[model samples]
Target: MEKTSGWRGTREIWIEAAYQALIESGIDAVKVMPLAERLGLSRTSFYGHFSDRDDLLKALVTLWQSKNTGNLIRQTEAYAETITEALLNVFDLWLLPDLFDSRLEFAVRNWAHTDQDLARMLEDADQVRVEALQAMFFRFGYDPDYARVRADTVYLTQIGYISMIKDRPSEPPGPRLQRMPFYVEVFSGRPVSDAEWARFRARHPVAS
Candidate 1:
């Protein structure tokens, strides 16, 4: 393990730099020496934050899970009174950048193609996210097998969306957001009221 002396700064600075590098270039560009140079500090400062490059990579995965999967699960539990509401709450992950990062997710997913360890980590994270979504469905009275399928459907759809959209998500939210209620109906085997639809539109207010 590497050691450092008197490095006084938050680990976020390094992680942010790594995140940028990962997004801009690829995982190989997220090196301690390069990051240290970018930050105008010695590589020793990295040891203050992470033990090595593998540690930094692990941190990046953790950050992605915490910000994307964790945030979506929190929103699902927080906003969903009904199955329709639950689906829209989860849809926010694709519709809004504030709730998740499509580019970063794409970057990590692409990286995973080359690294078995990263692939495993991502697979595990996927399971956790699906389970969390399943819990949300179960709370609304779905059976375990039914909820599991619904949860996988929602999670995989979002992942597919991220995979397809290569550029910064410039797609207008209005048209797509309009279809969310329909998607909810399909996924949950439930109907959405006009009032519920109106309320959802009011909350999002996507332009046509």
Candidate 2:
């Protein structure tokens, strides 16, 4: 029997490797051999864990959906008690990624196009995310319809922004990562410059 490569470090090893593989290549590129290689194991090891590439992909989608749903909702709540803070939290999720990966986002979205089954899986996961985000918006004082609309837009915007960043010119990337904060500010309607926030504060002094 082939050795099974799994549950290393903190979380499942094969699962983490799947996310890495998604990042390096789109879902189309995540073949069993390459994924096994990335995990520093043989195909026997990979098969021992997953019956095939499709099986592994299904597990990856399930794992990501469960974990990322919480992260997205938590991020939305960080700006709690204020609509702006809560809504901007969605933007924050997009700008700062740790709960999920950019490459995986790209791969699955592309994969959903031609594959009906995968498309259904993504639709269901998206529905859950939308529900979570909508609830956050409602908690922040929006009506159901508005919450639904805004949540969908924000969720989809993540896919759009990742596509832009991924398509950037390959000029070594430079130090342009700093610009992400600015993007967050614009998307979230937050004051990008400290000067702006300070000026607003001066106009409306604190009560205490």
Clash totals for all models, in order? 0, 1
Evaluate residue 186 in candidate 1 and report its C-alpha lDDT on the 0 to 100 scale: 86
What's the lDDT for residue 180 in model 2? Answer: 37
TM for candidate 1 is 0.83
Q: Which residue pairs show collisions in model 1?
A: none
lDDT of 1 by residue, 103-144 (tens): 899999999999998899889888888998999999999999
lDDT of 2 by residue, 78-179 (tens): 645455545544544543456655656677777788789878877877787888878876785677987787777767776666677667853232233344
lDDT values for all models: 0.83, 0.63
List candidate 1 stretches off by more than 4 Å. 1-9, 167-169
Which candidate number has the best TM-score? 1
User: Model 2 lDDT vs. the true structure?
Assistant: 0.63
